[model samples]
Target: MEIYNNHKRLYIAALLLFLALTLYAALIPAYKAQNDNAPLPNSKPLSEQEALGKAVFVKEGCVACHTQQVRNVEMDKFWGERPSVASDYARNKRPDIWRNTANLMGSERTGPDLTNIGKRQPGKEWHLIHLFQPRSVVAQSIMPAYPWLFEIKERAAAADVTVQVPEEYRKNIKGDIVATEDALNLVAYLQSLKQVSLPDGRPVPKFLYPKQSTPDLKGMGTQTEDAGLDGASLYAANCQACHQQNGEGLPGAFPALKGSSIVTDADPKALITVIMKGYNGRVKEGFAEMPPIGVNNNLKPEEITAIINHERTSWGNNASKVTVDEVKAVLAEIGK
Candidate 1:
């Protein structure tokens, strides 16, 4: 009761309490985190090139859309083998002086999680082309292209790394699309995002979506001689993501598969090759390049045949069905 009359004493007490809370809540935790000794297995510090690439990634605001941390929830398993622990971020830090969000563990995930992008998509060529034009590989992708990070040269020099851009996409540019040092560094950083496995005794969380174990649709077998391939189901499951259910494809990004010449072609050679090895931009206008679904997605010969048949027969196209033997022969000839 007497303290109520002592304003200065009360003010001093409140200030001391605030400082104590600040120390308990912030400083202590930061100090413990900085001193953590247990890091994830096989996790390495960034190389010089990768560090530069990280700067480029931060400069480009990549963290705004792509999250680097994988949460413990089951749904987040798609991004990494296991949930990210404190040790996973131990090696990720800015210098002592620079302290603007040192951990690039972004909040919003407008783009897919980049925590394990290095494992998901590792091809240097793919990253280069995708950076040059997101639409080139993913026609419907809204990711901004960083063309300014590349240089257009009349011809590639001995040291220049050229990417596969459709002629039309490169129109009015005098030279080939070559990766700049920044671009190379940026890709290096992207490629360094593999998820490190948790140390022993830490249980890996179960996947939210159980892996499919049963045999795929009738025609989904990888064997060359297997019959009863389910073309419709296979197409629905795999191709429909980009080609659309109706086979119309996304205009300007993905070509119309329903009435496309390649789909209706009698030979079926091109279709098989496209699915197996992937196709880069060929024309000067429209239709971004198609990544090799078979290889990247691990599609077998029978699966490829089923997809070809589905595209040929569906959407009023009257092309003949392809056999597994034919697909196998093509795969052999093309050395897939």
Candidate 2:
């Protein structure tokens, strides 16, 4: 009764209880995690610029919409090659003494998971344009544009990294859009978000409730006769994001395939070459470089033919369809 009535004793007991709870709940767990989970061998610490970008990402509330973790679920498989493990984030450290922002594995994936976005979309130009205006690239993107991360300059200097905003989005602004240092830094940090490959002989975690399989035509060649391959479906899966469903691409940002000279050309070499090696020649014309889709996506000859045929035939195009043999020959000739 005396101990309870004494203010000093009551305060001392409360302080001790708080200390014990903190030590057991926070300090002990943190210490165990630090000791038990070593960073993957291939994972490197973030560079200075990337660190700054990370701060900007947090400041911009990107964590609210985007998640960095890929769960061990079939649906999450699109975000990463393998299910994320603890060691995937082991290289993360506290930003500073004032902030414990080491774990940014956000919940609620309003936006697509960015666990392996670096590998999925590695184009700086794409990121720049997307940042300036999300709708420029993805017509249906619900993400907010971060226009403050860029500046409008009358004429960009040689040192300036300019974003080629589509004319529709830039109609009000009379100057070229240049990426600010923070924007570049943010892109750098985003580009650095690649999933590290596990060491050889390591048992990779499998995604649960595996979806029924379709034949993977990435590495192997499919029959020349289409063989149940739907060209429209292939185009939707691989090309629709840029070229769009109607084949009219976003003006100034992506070239339209509808009535395109390359798509309708009698010779298929140029078209196949562009698909395999990619095209950067249109940069001056405000078009971002097309990534080497055939190579990067590991598209087989039949798949490439399907995409090409779809482009050549659809959207009022009357060009002759390309065969798998022609595509294979071209791929071999180009050494792709």
- Choose the strongest candidate by lDDT: 2
Once fitted onto the true fold, the runs of candidate 2 whose alpha carbons sit more than 4 angstroms away are 1-7, 214-237, 246-309, 318-336
Count of clashes, each model: 5, 0
The best candidate by TM-score is 2
Evaluated at residue 215, the lDDT of candidate 1 is 61
Candidate 1 structure quality by residue, lDDT tens digits, 157-192: 988877766555666777778899999999999989
Instruction: Name the lDDT value of residue 226 in candidate 1.
Output: 34
TM-scores for every predicted model: 0.64, 0.78
lDDT of each: 0.77, 0.85
For model 1 the local lDDT of residue 26 reads 96
| Tens digits of lDDT, candidate 2, 252-286 | 66789999999999989999998888888988987
Candidate 2 yields a Cα-based lDDT of 0.85
